[model samples]
Target chain A: MAEFKKADSMLEWFDQRLGVVNFVKVMMTEYWIPKNINFLWAMGVLLTVLFTFLVVSGIFLLMYYKPDVNMAFDSVNYTIMQEVAYGWLFRHIHAVGASVVFLVIYIHMFTGIYYGSYKKGREMIWVSGMLLFMLFSAEGFSGYMLPWGQMSYWAAYVITEIFGGIPVIGDELVVWIRGNFYVSDSTLTRFFMLHVLLIPLAIIGAIVFHFYALRFPHVNNEEGEFFDFDEEAKKYLAGNKKESKVVPFWPVFLSKDFFVLGFFMLFFFYLVFFHYNFAMDPVNFDKADGLKTPAHIYPEWYFLWSYEVLRGFFFEIAGVSGKDLGLMAFGFANAIFLVLPWLDRSPMVKPANQRPYFKYWFWFLMADLIVLTVYGKLPPTGANAWVGFASSMTFLALFIALPFITKAEAKKVGGK
Target chain B: MKEFKILAVIAALVGITYYGIEPYAHHIMHPEVAPADFSFKTLKNVDTTLAGNAENGKVLVEANCIACHAIDKAGYPAIMPNADAAASYGVVPPDLSSSGRIYDKNYLANFIFDPVSAMHLEGKYTPESGKQFPMPAYNWMSPQEIMDIVAYLQSVTPKVTEGKETNKATFEAACGRCHDMKYAGIQATTPKDNLKAYMGATPPDLSQYIKSRGEHYLHSFVNDPQVLLHGTSMPRVGLTEKAQEEVIAYMEEIGDSKKAERESLGIWVMLYTFVFAILAYLWKRKIWSEVH
Candidate 1:
């Protein structure tokens, strides 16, 4: 039996039973992150701040929020917005947190891409991060349905219906997922369960896995300068830190992260208070009616780029339907992010600055996503249809062109 | 410089998307429907500044308007119950108790002179279209007679109190006829089915309207719906400037009650974050100075 021996202090007693001393040393003091890393590296911690915002605000909303089709609208719009004191503030923080989380996620993802942080041994960190991104997207979409507004109802209906476009188990899959033939009370209840519980738990798991994964390869930094952590940690431990090329994760690295977080909160709370409408769609204020559809319907800004890709294929060609083909393309777009490590053949261990071809690819991908997002919000008719289709093709073409460009870049790696 | 370049690219990409594409796309999709008759330029002869004897105005209103609208504040009742009125007119006739306070004096006179033309419903309520307006034109009445009736309605309706609950009075007078405020326990006076038939769509409850339709859009659309939706059946209620403001403010009170709290709290939160940001920066500089 592991018996706790009486010690000089409570801390020493706990450290004897649990390896608290070693745990802290391993996780914080001994763990190293690159010193040369820029402020963009702070995005991961900023995402944690956003998650905390959503969780805390979500708990307050859940106290009053009903999941029924009829009651959900009143619960959110009337009880929370009107009756409960400062309910509007909680709702605003949550809605804004859900939206801004993605803004940071995209930056985090793009930052990874720019620095080739997903290269070689660090693939698991990127993969785990993408998993969290996917989980967060699900979390956001499900929570959106809890409002039971026109946009909420229809967005749910539209997204769930997209699953019906799959090949064999399509129709049945849609029914099972919705728990009804159409989006009804059952759909709302199940979505409510996933939103408040199941998916969020999964996201927590993924975030834990992501942080755990980061410990392995450690964090890749701004210039993609590789460091032997074991070797550098000794120098850091010996108090000769100037030449260590690394800093401890806790006090040294986190100081910059907290600074970035404070700055981020300034922008966040400004939107939470003054510019709230950017997150809350006006249409969502109207109670959900299955019979009535809004004149213009689209996902939130974060999902618009991928949604545009889904809507981009406007025509049926080569026997397959456009709807089915678009679904396939959308699926590919989502899955492609997880496979970036295997696709880029470049042997570079540096930022996009040091690699010319990969840098262009990164910018092109950014611009194409912007174009897709812009065209996504517009009604897919006339010129929009053509541009959206071209942009959709470009999105897919970027991934296809990845190995080709990077393979060529491998030849230039040694010269640099 | 490289980091700065990266930040520039991000800012430019975001700017082009939000400021450039988003607004442009919305402008094209939902073109700003400028108010067509904000000044009510269609009615030229509605001169409300004319003097009228309250006694004469009361007599005229009793003779004509009391048959349909119950001016209960003035001790007049409609000749029929609400159901019978709804069955006959396809909607319950609104009580005229607060007409003097809520409706603009010019609009009241114009509405009586020609119901269809005053509301710009000439396109819908035409002889060829067979869609008769519920309220018939009182064109036979002299201009002086119409003005007298309007004056009588105004005089009979009690003056809205200066500061207290004036908002509620204006809201009830302007919108209580067709819309339900379920959260406040104020059901629509007219039946939903009757309203649906009358206006081609039932008026939505106003409890969450401030949140649903933003403050600016609500003001514009309430003043004139036809500008935003060309074929909308909602008639221009023609509220006076003060009455309109009161009603919109009342909607905000019910729908967005925490607005004051939110704004006040926002100031503190913003200041806290800003101050913390500066402190964090200083701390980071000190900590990093120890690092290298």
Candidate 2:
């Protein structure tokens, strides 16, 4: 009660009793962030806000969406679009929000990579973030099924069929995932549960851990130097008038975060209200049909790089099934990203501009990813497959050769 | 102040861009109407009250339809060779087995009165092109006689061996003459190029028609093709109400069989998410307010 001596109002009285005021001050208001980071830093906060929007809008859609094969198409087209009040708005937001969320996350990830944010003590943060990315993929795939459109049905079939390429229990595994001999009622029901409940809960848990890991490391800056928060606090306590390199989370970073969020929202709301089908496929308007597969079957754009890698390796290696190997290659592509911290043996954790060789390699990887994404969208035939193969090889080589390449570059440049 | 101004400009640009392009994008995404020249009213006003016995309908189908159509599941060895039929009429007549299930009875009766008018192909083709009007007008037949034929077709349901039934037999009997079934792994007996030359447009494979058009649209279109899209070579395959329902059921079985289960579980999912969202909102507000 003595702590309440400075309490000035009724709200302060409740804060004194709850101690939530202290918790907030410690976690947010008093927290120090580097002032040198750019707008890329805002993507993490934007992703969180977008994820919230997705979940809320998704809930509204789930209210009217039918996951059954027969009614699923009609429910979305007739019931949601034509019947429910403002259902079109929610549906468009959820659909388009998915692509925008992935765009933000990709930028956030590239920002981490470009600045070596995954180095040293922040490995756990990187791991948690990668896990969240994996969960996001799972969430996206499962949500794609809820529509039960032509694309949804065929994509599920093709992806599940990939499991059947395994050697011993492949057929059984496919059946296990599908919950039946084919992608049917049981499959749709199971995927619905996973999309709406299971994967989202997992994403929330992963996000909490990601933030927790992030808290210890603070944030990586352009200089790649450790920030001392205690020294900054001491300066503030002593009534120093000089400008500090470290800024408070509130007002400083908060204003910038809000500004960026508002800008992003303007664009997002435009897409939702005006160009809602910007990234959607027209063929998906039709209902699911197992007997008739669409000419081209592909996952969302975020997954295209890995999907292209899988398609590139569509040939038998020795006696192993090419399909199985392709699936393995795809999984390995994603797994490599999770272990990037250990893969690079360089002692210095400088920004890309300071590390010339590292910068070139990073840009090469980005180019490779872009090539794969484009190739994945095109028909996998003749020259396209060969190009995809070359890009896939380059992608693997970049990760595998990173340590040696960086080590050699360090020796040539003389140690920093 | 600089940051504020930049943000204000960005906001203004977004608003301007949104308002400027919104109407055009809307027009593209959802066109105001179907193309002008391809318009025809649905047979919503056609009378469908006439009822006919399946047994009598069977006799009528044997007397009139058997010459051009195979009414049974075993559709091969049709009375006229498909090539000769295609050469003579510009489009080979479809089999009649599944017509009852895939069309509306009212549309079936109206289409029977004038085949060329029902399909809007009165002068779309000429004899010099070897693409004359395909189906002969059967307006002389009474509405009850057509209804009987439809009833008979409806009675010939595909045998369901298990929970699922294949539409192979139904599709082959009805759509095999003009359209190929190659996508579904069934080979076409007629030469595709000749059929295409005769019909003008290659009849699309019907294997995925159920998935594409849906049951409601399929019913209307199948009853009278011209009503949905003008100047198509597809003749109205006049079928009874019961027959159309059966065909739609067959299509559904082959296509979206799990639709019922998918729709039924949506409500619970919505309720759960709603409760979770409210709790999440409260938690976010509480946590976020600490910084404020």
DockQ of 1: 0.73
Q: In model 1, where do residues sit more than 4 Å from their true spots? A: A2-4, B1-5, B20-22, B36-38, B45-53, B78-81
| Predicted candidate 1 versus true structure: per-residue lDDT over B1-292, tens digit per residue | 9768867878887788886345687677777776634457667666657776678888887777777888888788777887788888887788898888788778888899888777766767768977898888888988888888887888888865765388977787788878898877888777888888888788888888887787777778887777786777778888877788888898888877788888999999999999999999999999999877
DockQ of each: 0.73, 0.04
lDDT of 1 by residue, A231-261 (tens): 9888888998888888998888999999989
Tens digits of lDDT, candidate 2, A356-395: 6888898798778877876776677888888988998898
Model 1 chain A: ten consecutive residues of lowest lDDT: A407-416
lDDT of each: 0.86, 0.70
Q: Measure candidate 1: CA RMSD.
A: 2.0
Clashing pairs counted in every model: 0, 12
Highest DockQ against the true fold, candidate: 1
